[model samples]
Target: MKPLVMRIVFWSVLVAALAILAGVVYEQYGRYRAARDFPAPGKMVDIGGGRRIQLDCRGAGSPTVVFEDGLSIDGSLSWAAVQPAVAQRTRACSYSRAGLMWSDASNAPRSAKQVAQDLREALMRAGERGPFVLVGQSLGGLYATTFTRYFGSEVAGLVLVDPSHPDQVARVAAFMTETRSLRSRIAVSLAWTGLLRAAAPSLLPQAPNQTEHDAQAVRAFAPKSMVTQMAEGDATDAVLAEAGAFRDLGSRPLVVLTAMAPYTGSELRGMQITPEQGVQVQAIWEKMHEEMAAWSSRSAHRLLPKAGHDIQFDDPRAVVEAVLSVVEAVRAEGGTPPG
Candidate 1:
């Protein structure tokens, strides 16, 4: 009886090993196929050290609208809703930081300063010169601000969407560590194993047309990108602090868009946020947004009543109009046109 049980256990272990191996190989093959099918849409611009960052620019005119995505989100993909529309009015460029879909991974730790430098170099190399109207969402706001600080003369306008406050980590460290940071780290780790592939829905679900839908075929499960995203998430404290240093935007046409909608029941539960905590979070977020608006003397704080955190996807028209308004305002000023 003992020998029989031992043989059974050995076989069980062997079978499990085979299954995991098969899953890994299968997922890798799928990734190779996806890459072949959906190559990066834009040019891969070299940003020093022979490392490349993807820059997808559309339409024409000035000042050029440059997009920076949230920390964990796809840089160009997340701007699906608003880019094309804004492109129609003036040139719009969506750029992926190092280690995103088409961008090369960076050996150095992720920081707002590095992102700002990388973008500045890439734009100059790509000949996508300023004056740029920078549009940043979530953590991208930090990168955008850092860029403006380093090259304020080149920036014509700014739009921050539900931006991350420098003090946000300090304000809700416990909540972020307990809920978002842990969950995100785990999810990103699982992505490499193809575990999150099943849950990888359309990067932009509210995509109006099939073209936009098909364009978002890239997956977020690449090992390099996953590591990069986790690194950025981990370094939020430093990034936010770096962004906080440059508060004064002078007279740039700044528009701060805040998502004021209540979190859905599922979202609340997912974040493990209690009703009281939810209220507190909203108040803190709005207060921080107001303070960010005050950074620019010519800034306006616009509240989105129905939009959620991803205002671009939730209210594309609103985002488009906001971007166009800023672009038109800058152009009206007769700023130096892109060379």
Candidate 2:
């Protein structure tokens, strides 16, 4: 029995050492590979010294529609289903924020306010003649509103897909502070390390129809695997950023899309969120809708019955319609949406 116990302990130490060595090598290789093959947002102009912000211009006409992706590594591909349909009637585009796929990692700042400013500069540099109808998903919603407020005159209308809510941030923070889960903490650490690694890679422009490609680009920079803690940290930070952006918005024509379903992806399931949590999130969204309703007289809310946080991917047609309506409203007002 004593000999067996000792052997077990020796093997455990060996496994631990192997893990550490593997992690160090992977990190070094990842950083090096990322720097060499970082996706570039081609023909996309940089603003504020980072290529993370990119513009993909398509079609032409009136009330140009601009789409901004949510947090994580999302890009214009999130609008894959919606942009083309909208482009048929008016000028439309979807952009990758800095540190996201096809966009250069940013070193300046990651605040919503800073991101909005970058969008402003990108538009000017790209020569995108706007009365842009700004559309955003999740954290992108925060940036969209910030842009509208800073460049109020340039904005024609707004569409927010599962837009981040400030109150939601408080709730998330409270939960994280109270929860003492080791799994959650480890997950967060892994996620941050991956994000940091992506920071070193250069940004590039991608194909308009290359949704899968875009996903692959962003995935390449993520850690070998995800853990629960990493997800919690990411979610918490997102909510906090949304809260900050919410405080700065002004009255604007806006349409917000809220999700009705809980996400059931492999990642989400791995996190062990239960059906009860789904119901709770729906309830939270209801309250969030009420809070957002007070933002403007024209502000309205829509429910995406099938989607979770990533509403666009779940139901692109609905997002397109909501965005188109905003574009029309801006055009009707004889104004261009903010680019």
Expressed as tens digits, the lDDT of each residue in 1-339 for candidate 2 is 999999999999999878767766767787567546754443567575435456777788877788887765546667776888898989987877665555566556356666778777887888886777888887677777777767777777788888876666566442223244575455446543444344323332343344655545555544422332133235556545554554433455778888887556652455455566656656876777667756766778887777767767777888888887877777776773333
lDDT to native, each model: 0.79, 0.66
Candidate 1: which stretches are off by over 4 Å?
1-6, 172-187, 190-192, 199-224, 336-339
lDDT of 1 by residue, 1-339 (tens): 999999999999999888777767766876787678767768899777979988999999988999999975455777877888998988899987888777888888678888898888888998988889999999998788889888888998899998988888677765544335676577667665665554466322434322444434545334446667778777887888888898888888889999988888876887688877877888889999999999887788999989888888788888888888888878788964221
User: What TM-score does candidate 1 get on C-alpha atoms?
Assistant: 0.89
lDDT of 1 at 82: 83
Worst 10 residues of 1 by lDDT: 202-211
